[model samples]
Target: MRVVTATNAVKDERQAGGLVVEVIETTSLGDRSYLVSDGEVAVVIDPQRDVDRVIAVAGRLGVRIALVLDTHVHNDYVSGGLELARLTGAEYGLAAADEVPFERRPLADGDVVQLSPRMRVRALATPGHTFHHLSYALEGAEGPVGVFTGGSLLFGTTGRTDLLGQQHSEELARHQHASAQKLASMLPDGAQIWPTHGFGSFCSATQATGDSATLGEQKWINPALTLAEGDFVEQTLAGLDAYPAYYAHMGVQNTTGPEPLDLREPVRAEPEELRSRLDHGEWVVDLRSRKAYVVSHLAGTVSLGLDGPMVTWLGWMIDWGAPITLLGESREEVGAAQRELARIGIDKFAGAAAGTPEELAADRSQLRSTPTATFSDLAAALAGDSDGFPAPEVVLDVRTNKEFAASHITGAVHIPLYELKDRLGEAPAGAVWVHCGSGYRATAATSLLEAAGRTVVLVDDTFDAAAAAGVPMTEPGESSSSS
Candidate 1:
């Protein structure tokens, strides 16, 4: 584990003694899959549901995939390890303690998976991210090169412990602490740490910082290493936030052997079918920019733009296994969204339509638009003048609880975007203006509110621009405005 620069640039490939470790990033899901090869043979770790990417990498490197391993039963994207193994005629591996229906090369603590004469992976039971999580230390003839930590030890923090359940969180936190310490002691200080989660995934207890790190570097920055076990457990639990609701299905899908991904184009939908799906309350996702969506869209279609975290938020907001139809500006856009959804096990679509809002609409009557605003506009509105824009009866902040607690518009109603689906009744009636940290979540919130028959305006501006726009802000527990 050579010390790379302290900058955020993460190299897609790193060199070991005689091996090349290629990083396959799923930025949308905020996870990384690795293809570690000894030139002639390779081992893929923590692949996503779309195994094609891993296969493509292996083919490009001209290496035969000899083994596919999972650090744990993932709770984020469905694991592609099983399917990748089956496709490549490679042995699938995981903790022997994990009870999965599929047959795998069950690996226990200290099990060695020899990849070549000079390269091998030594499995170490590193439970706490899950009950039976295992981290793989990639060893070269000289010594260990790096460790594939999965969710056990991230760059700056550990994986969240509550995904299994709150009842087990404290106990797991203790295990997580011990696990991180164990890795620190077993591996050399210079061994590079390759983690599967924590780039931006909710799997991390807190957002992990830094793009790369060594065991020596992490010992100074990672809470699991710096804090006492009890302090680490308490801090880890307190830092946990709401993860995507779709996570509840991933572990089960992984353990049962996820179905091979279906990247084939979905059934082409007509305007009439699109309207019917919307009418019946099926999820009709609009894959355009929020700016375009605000100007016009099919009524009731949710705004999960392709340019943002569409997959994570859509997977979080939609009812699992619900009929979903995609509406995009082009076939490519629809295809791209479909591929991303597949990574999270959203394999089937009710239908998909590619066209402009006008073309997708059966009639002009089916089209609708919402107003857009900025905090400056809201500031003016509060002063009884808004350049003819209607003054909002309610200022709705759709940012997360932590964000709202840190700072928000004075007198704004707080409802996180995820909760808006069920808490629509809690929103005050009349003209409402919604916003989030950025315009993305706010755009989604506006469409949701509008579909529920509320008059909504989207604040399509960054939150940092609020104070500069002369909007009064307040922090929670403060009696007076901050600025």
Candidate 2:
């Protein structure tokens, strides 16, 4: 794994023998798109919907992009493979089973694509990640340099099979096991695994082992290798949880062929326009820091922080077709947010405004304070002895069941952040105190609740901090950790 540093993480570079695989890592999605070239012709794999970055890289490298290949119709973000191919005059290739409603080179198992005389790419039908996934094996003059495993086999575990829906989960899990076995059996010990997901992707069923792992090392340590087919399926299915709501939209759009992206500049909106849009029920997502958001913000405006996983939550909590407005601390921050938001196929940017809450608000009345409480503050409130406490309407825990089950504050409501949208009614009304392992999901929860006209308090503290603060809590092994 040889790294070539350039501008930043967005357009990083890596080497595989004679191949230069430019890594476009979308930090928000925890996914990577590769622009691989054997110094003559380039091929892009699992590209983000924003195709300009890939194009820019290709232009810099001075290699003609001959092909655009997708591992599968992605669920996490819109596929830019088709759009990039269209823009570059490159031949686009996807799995035949994906049934994409347009013409392209239908890639199949064992199909060899010659990059050059000495360099070639062989397609391997690695199903289980959406049932139409393909892994491309790269062969250079020095035997096999690497395998682009996509979602079939990852750094530690394989991509979760349950994203297609509940009915197909079990069957897909079985396919995933067989697919991992196949890759391990066919590929040599030294083959470098370049996965599209699993660095920090939720698509990974479990935590990442490390950045990258070899086929030989994975064979010994990967949990997928140790389990039988049925047991593997059962274990995988059990670990699955709620995915983003926008995921339901990606697969169908890919099959029907996505509309070409509009990468034009976002227009600026005035404070008066912001108020008018909000009055008309359009979402104005503030991409400010969480601390800034909690300290002071527009009364009804929701905070989707500029840092961390903006697209996933933006897609999940907001309607895709709905008109949206963005607010950031500066024009540059707004530009950054717009670029990331576009990856999820959100192109409808009505306008954007860059200002603090004071400047953005038409009147001081539109500004409000959303307090951030720590676990200690939460404990004091639950005890009903803290001064000016209103009996703490709900101590909401927004972490996954895995984290929640580990150790949670007593009397806290358990609702995973991903599922909070549809289950809003299940949450108690008024003064809802929210906390996750850290404050990211808690901020998300806060914004969600605040958008729905409920008062929210972010538990902006670590789980261990809460435990150390002597907040009434239950240990992991306790029969009941419920408050």
Candidate 3:
């Protein structure tokens, strides 16, 4: 199940010996950065590209920033570690073996950095997510409080080993298994487990559930702790799936030093200019909710709503450094998208506009709409009920392969969202009806299909509704159903 937390950014001040570990969650990206403090001194771990949040937390707690560290050269988002350290004049450290162009305090396994008389951090080599990954063990006057397991040992799963390459995936899986064993052997059962990935991060081998966990708790549930090394390696490798294509750029950005964040509002784009940009094949993304965009939006503008994984989808599909123009109902929406984009190293924007579709479009002709429906509506359409809309010629399932394999509408064409850009033409010719696990991914696919001049309907409802709606369902290897 997808872990749904109430808020994206939350803090957990529970720590031993007056230490405060503030969890700075980037819910949009399914990752967390930490601001661990011992009353007067603070240290940050795996910070995002926007370092302002970390700085604000430190200021609120009235702690002097003593050090900033990266658990690993991140593969999901640009690391804000260097910038945060530079801004605060704190020691910036990473695994010593990671070759980079910038200067950094190199840390080796078993190395300890004194934060205060009562608090210090110990580095342990745990190479699963990356070759030089490190997990920091935070020690206090009482003893070990917790360990910052970047991507090594997550709450219930370990980080995927295939991010490096398929050739090294199994090899890395072995190291990952060994690393988790090492951590379990060294740390006590009560030690809190603070991981940077696995909340919902694609870096995780599987979707991890749980907001907080102790080593004791994980021992029973975490695959890394429960399975034998050989079994763990096989299970982890088998469970891997496609991650966002934007992940290809994140590691390089982190290692080479990411560009300084730029969240400044872009120059406003007039209606004519927005039309010209769209005509020329530039990305004009509408930041409105899919529910709103499907009803009415500028023709050709794709719906990557600020309400969903906008950055991940936009970054994955758009050409790197493409001239992106954001359209939202208000400046606040545009501003929010800008910060989220910046987190993934999308620093350049062609322009931006904030207004309703009617306000942004030069003429009513420029606005277009795609029909939206729920599973019941689709079921009626399939049954040829005159009260429902026309029967769709095609039903497109745009969820991941694993999601489709588990259970999906019978006879629906399967095309994973990430692969849609390259395989658009492969979609069968007809008025298409599309759905995903939820409406989020389907909306993205619907926008793409509409932009490609295909007649499409967005199934904007939960997958659970399909069975109840009498929509025929089947899994892999099952007999074919009528299209």
Candidate 4:
């Protein structure tokens, strides 16, 4: 077996058993899009936002993209399956039970998608990451060659099960454990494992250090794979991070499909056009890093730094149903930002603002800035009930379930920011107060709640402020109703 990393700067490839598997790593999300072929036909797995990358790679390799499969309905990035399939006239596939909007071939457990005489994919139903999660085992001349794990099995940890629902945790954990054991038992020791998400991914606690690892290595070192079923469940549930607020929207977008956005011809908007859209309720998503955003940003733009998990945050913070205009430092930056957001299924881009700062600045009414709250000011607000502050019952903790369970303000309703949309109806209509572990997520929650026609007071202070103010604190894993 030999591996050759594709050098196009946009695609990656490795060869085994005379089969070439090209991986298109999205610059926007770090999510990998794969093209597996044995020269004549190809199968793409979890393609990123851009179809051009896959099309170009397939053209270069002299192969056709015959089938497109999404491991599951993605929450962090949009799947390019629909776009790629439409462009190439390939069959799109989803797990048999998946209820996505597009036409798809139903892939079931043990079903094989044959690419060529020497290459094929055996679909393994590995639910729990998402209800319809599927992992693919690549069989080549070398036998069971590699496995595309998607988000079900990461390098060290497994996918967070809490994203689906709190009530589903125990059942999900049980299924996740079963899936891990099933994969472990079936895959050969030397079979390589490739995952869609890597480091810096919010989906996994930790990604594999290298791009790919072996099943044998995972058996010995992967915590989720190595632990007893019950322990695996406990550790995964315990180490869970706060689910990003954008996850729910991303799920719906992935299932329903995003409207196509063409990347080849950059859609440049004039300053007046940008302002008009903003006036009409379109949001300006500034996709620069936090430092760049802080230094300067278009007025009234929400910053989901390009350097961080921008797409994930964008899907969480921005209204998926709303139109978005992008502002980046350069054309490449804008395209990259667009690709990242597209991965999570947000394709409703009106256009990108083009030209020099001076050109954009000529229209003063068009530009606004992000509001910044100091740590001290946030602390002051949390410490004492200022004039007109709402009562304790009105306070809402908008952090993740894990974060709220870890520590939270007394009498605050526990509403993980990701679940805010579904749970918002449960919140009392008047004077709802919200806070997160820090000010960032809280600000995002406040913005959404405000947009929903609810009056919200944002608590941007640190957790210690609650303690200093004699507000009772509940440790994580304790019932919110407990004192």
RMSD of each: 2.7, 2.5, 2.7, 6.6
**Candidate 4's residue-wise lDDT over 1-483, tens digit each?**
344344344324444577777766664454676777887898889886667778888889899889898899887776678878888899998888888677888999999977777888899999878888999998986678888888877776677687788888767877888888889899988877777875456777544465567888888887767788888888777776665666766677678876675555347887777667655656766665544544444555555556655676666655556778787777788877766665665555778874434455547644433334433433444566444544333677776665666687656777776667567688865676666665556655665565465665666566666666566567765656622
What lDDT score is found at residue 408 in candidate 2?
A: 75
lDDT (CA) per prediction: 0.89, 0.81, 0.88, 0.70
TM-score of 4: 0.71
- Candidate 4 global CA lDDT score: 0.70
lDDT of 4 at 210: 58
Least accurate stretch of 10 residues (summed lDDT) in model 3? 1-10
Between candidates 1 and 4, which one is better according to lDDT? 1
TM-score, cand. 3 vs. native: 0.96
Question: What's the TM-score of each model vs. the native?
Answer: 0.96, 0.93, 0.96, 0.71
Ordered by lDDT, highest first, the candidates read 1, 3, 2, 4
Give me the overall lDDT of model 2: 0.81
TM-score winner among the candidates? 3
Identify the superior model by TM-score, candidate 1 or candidate 4. 1
| Residue range 14-101, candidate 3, lDDT tens digits | 4447777778888889898888887899889999999998888888879999999999999899999999888999999999999999
